[model samples]
Target: MLAIDFQHVTKRFPGVVALNDVSFNVRKGEFHSICGENGAGKSTLMKILSGVLTDYEGDFFVNGTKTGFTGTRDAESVGISIIHQELNLVEELSVAANIFLGRELRHSFFLNEAAMFAESQTLFDQLECEIHPRQNVSELRVGDQQLVEIAKALSLKSDILIMDEPTSALTETEVERLFRVIEMLRNEGVTILYISHKMEEVFRLSDRITILRDGQHVKTLNREETTPQEVTHLMVGREIELIRLGKGRQATEPVLEVSNLSLLWPGHARGWKLKDVSFTLRKGEVVGIAGLMGAGRTELLECIFGASEDLPEGRILLNGEVVNFRHPSEAKEAGIAMVTEDRKRLGLFQQMSVRENITICTLPDSVSTGIVHSRTEAAAAKKSIDELGVKTATAETAITSLSGGNQQKCIIARWLRTQPEVLLLDDPTRGVDVGAKAELYQVIDNLCKDGLAIIVTSSELPELITLCDRILVLCEGHLTGELAKKDFSEERIMELATKLAD
Candidate 1:
């Protein structure tokens, strides 16, 4: 029997149709994957099934009975659970508390804390995770927090699970661990509905694959019968040429140099977040940073951009001139710009228009004697939109109206407007689709040809291998190894990334 069936499912928002007459079915105990480009109906369909969008026009069946959930609680009551792409845990709560929240065991008006901790431990054990129940959710890294979310869902004992981009924030090792847990659950008769832009993950874990584009169902195919190229064609309705780095692009004169960089971490056994890290970046070359979570990848970028909480004990030189930036604005003025890792929280002004967001860093250029020049701002925004190919109705449209990939392009465009000598990008393609990622790669390549020095960090190792001229590996706050293009391999990078710090 089919574990899930959707009939004529359609969802519409204020100014857009998110899903239109989409229909598919999942056999019991099977792993089903949904693939689409950004702004496709994948998330909307999952939201409808998980009862987050109850007003959507649809008919759904769970295990053979017609059902429409009224709310998340109703969905939970019927064995439906969803782990959203953006984590849904309260940051300040303990792991145990988060797992048993709203469903706390009580003994005559007293909360059963011990029982909740025990139950949470059992769930973690099932996943073979070693997180402590008493640890604060905020204290955990993104990968660990993801595990906590999985544990919370398992505690519900849900027969059907919906995971949307679950591995988007995870390290490769953590992703492998998650795949193991998912396989175990599938063997125990749980149906999984997975959504991801990653073609490899979809191909690896899915028994059947569903494709969506522009709010409409394209097709559904068995995994064994479809290739990644075929799936990519279905997702974007076109063939995308993969981007490659220019060969023989060697580093020339150093544009930026870091010497004896070190950051002290106050609350750890290891006293430093970064220990004597040193590197040099040249004009027209892309450098990549590789590391596991908590290995100081983002922190290194933050320190370079002057956004770190604590200043490092080191020397930074730009064009052979010693410099120290007290803030990001100072760094910007010195021809250095950083596109932060967390775009939603740190990179964008969610409520502002695309034009405003793009021209925010270059406000002086758009002002004349204390008066703002709207035309100049609009023209600059339009130029960036055109250059980056940001899909939007107009420059005046809210930034949030665009998809994740376009939003990232907007962020990149914002930095490009600054015309920096050095661009620091943190996980530039974290949640982007293959088509959009290719576009971004093309942009990066063009920038490099124009002599803009770039430094990028990504969780996906293959991305670095494809885009970077050189790769630096950090392990436990230390620079363990560096690999050139000829020596690049996932196994070699992982070895360096997991090396013990001396």
Candidate 2:
């Protein structure tokens, strides 16, 4: 039986056709995986099915009944529940409150707080997670918050669940727990529609996979009959060459050095977030920071960029001179640039145009007598767009209108205009697609060859191995190991990442 049947679907945004004549079907009680690059209409089609979008040219049937959903409640009424990629929980509320936000339990005219809490606890128990029902959502870690999302979906008793990059923020242990929950749901005859970029998870769980590209349906293949390589090729509509980094360059003069860097963490079991961490980057060198979540990889980069909340107790030397940067502006002024990990929150100005975002940092170069030169700014943005291969209709388009990969390219181009001596990238390819990742890797390699020093942090050890000349592993606020490119291995990095310092 077909749980979902979408035929001749077409969705258009203001300046782009998001979905173009896409048609697909999902069997009831089966695990279906959706594969696509960024802006490939995978999410768009799902959004239409879930009623996040209502005005689209298509015919959609749910459980053999043709339906036109007006809103999320309409979809939910028909046993459709979607867990968005960006978390939608209210941080100020308790976990129980977030779970029953719109569908609160009531006792005659009063709210049934105790009943809701009990139900939430039962949901958490089912997921095998330890999140307290009464705990504030803000106090919980990201992985726990993701579990709460799952629990919320489970609470709805929806037979059809759509998970959009549900494990993007989860830890390895949390992922295992989630997979077990999925298995339980499958046993209960629930249908699952999962969207993810990770090939391993998709292949392991999906009974069938559907590939989409450029807002169109490409192919649907049974898991047993297809391979990851074939799916990737279909999604991109071309064979993606493996990322091959150039030969490592000889280390020249030191560009940046840090000694005994430490940041105090108050009211925690650990007294410090980083303890006496030190490293050095020479000209034309790329150093990778490898660590698990909370291993201080991001903190290390924040300290170097002068963006950390707590002042670090240590010394930083740039170009053989002691430099103390109180703010990120100071670091930028001193020939250092950083691309942050959280792109939505930290990197792009969502309200601004692509041209403005590209030239915001280097506006001075496009200004004369306190008047901003529009033509010069546009030219500079255009140049960066072309150089970075940003696929955008125009420089004046809104930054948020672009795909994840293009928005990232604009951010990278923004920093490159500064022409810094050192660049800091914290998981530059966190949510980017495979094709864009290859392009970004080549861009990074080209920059390194041009004598730019860089320090990068990534959750994927394979990514680090492919890009870095040396990898520095951190565990519990301490530098546990450093491996040369020849010595790089995922097992070695994981060992050092989990090791505790005495």
Candidate 3:
């Protein structure tokens, strides 16, 4: 059965044509995906399908019934539900309340709290998820909250589910759980429309793929018949920068030494986020941490930044002197800076102007007589923007107005305020365009030339090969092995990644 059909659909934003006469069809019970770059109209098309955007320019059909969805409720009325890249949960509500918010069980013309909890609990059990329906939504981890979103969408009894970048924030275990749920939905005759930039996950999850470029339709292919390289070419329209094992080598002394670092998850039952992970970083060198999702790459950086917790066991040493940080401020004071994995959520305050966001972190350096020197701040902002080559009408523009790449450059500017001796970055180029990614590589290289020890975590193995002096492989919270620059290759990293317990 055909679940959805969009014929010559077009979406437009101010000064940008988001989707240009896009058309595609989705089959019932099949896992279908849309692939594109960040600004390629993938999100805009999903919004149109979910009825978040209504002023589109073409035909819309659901389940072979020609109709136009005016709003989200109308889309839902036709057995359709959507989970956005950034979830839309009410943080104050309980898990049960978020799931059955609009359609609640009533008692004598009043609310029925007990009935809601009971019903939500039943759904959780049916899905084999361990989330508590009574728990506040704010308390759940990102992975668990994503599961809650999926469960909530399923609770609507919808035959078609639209998921946008669902695995972008998920750990490997959480992704497996989601894959299981998706399989169950497919088996029960539900259609899925997935949107993502991560080609690996898309290939792993989708039955067929529909490629979109600049809001126009590209091509659709069977999952088995297509290859990642071929899919990547179709999405980007060219061969991307593969892992570059640099010709130059750095042999400087150790600038950052992490000894037996370990931190607790506090919520998980079995183990900690990092299990005694130890590594060394040297000035003029870049060390890359390679792992699957949830292999503790982000957690390791968080521990180093003092953003999560104190290293109860491990000691971080700069210039061979033991340093401990109980908070992010202390870490920043110690000349240690970390760029978070999720740039939108953790890195930037979208409402703030680019100038303010860039210079906010460097006030101490840009202050005069205890008051901020606006001139110095502006100069610093301009300098970084010019050096980073970020595209914007003006530095006074809102951070949200720029594309994903430019927004990332702004975050990079914020960190540059603290002239750090060591820099830790997590997936720095996840959503940026190719041109921006190249610019960031140059920025990183310049920093390395300035003798700053750098450590970064990335799932793109090709990136690791190109960007690092060495690559460390982590598997299930264990540091499996290290690959020197000369020995760095995708095949070797894959070997260490999959090497399990004897």
Off-target runs (Cα >4 Å) in candidate 1 are: 125-130, 247-250
Per-residue alpha-carbon lDDT of model 1 for 232-331, expressed as tens digits?
9999999998566665465678999999899999987889999999999999999999999888998898898898888888999999998877799999
Scored against the true structure, residue 330 in model 1 reaches a CA lDDT of 90
For candidate 3, the per-residue lDDT at 50 reads 86
lDDT of each: 0.88, 0.88, 0.80
Candidate 2, residues 361-464, lDDT tens digits: the string is: 99999999999999999999999999988878789889988876688899999999999999999888766778888889998998998899999988667789
Question: Model 3: runs farther than 4 Å from truth?
Answer: 27-29, 55-59, 64-66, 105-130, 204-208, 219-227, 262-277, 289-297, 309-314, 363-397, 401-406, 429-450, 458-502
Candidate 1: worst 10 consecutive residues by lDDT? 242-251
Provide the lDDT at 291 for model 3.
Answer: 81
Backbone clashes in model 2, listed as residue pairs: none
- Per-candidate TM equals 0.93, 0.93, 0.80
Better of 2 and 3 by TM-score: 2
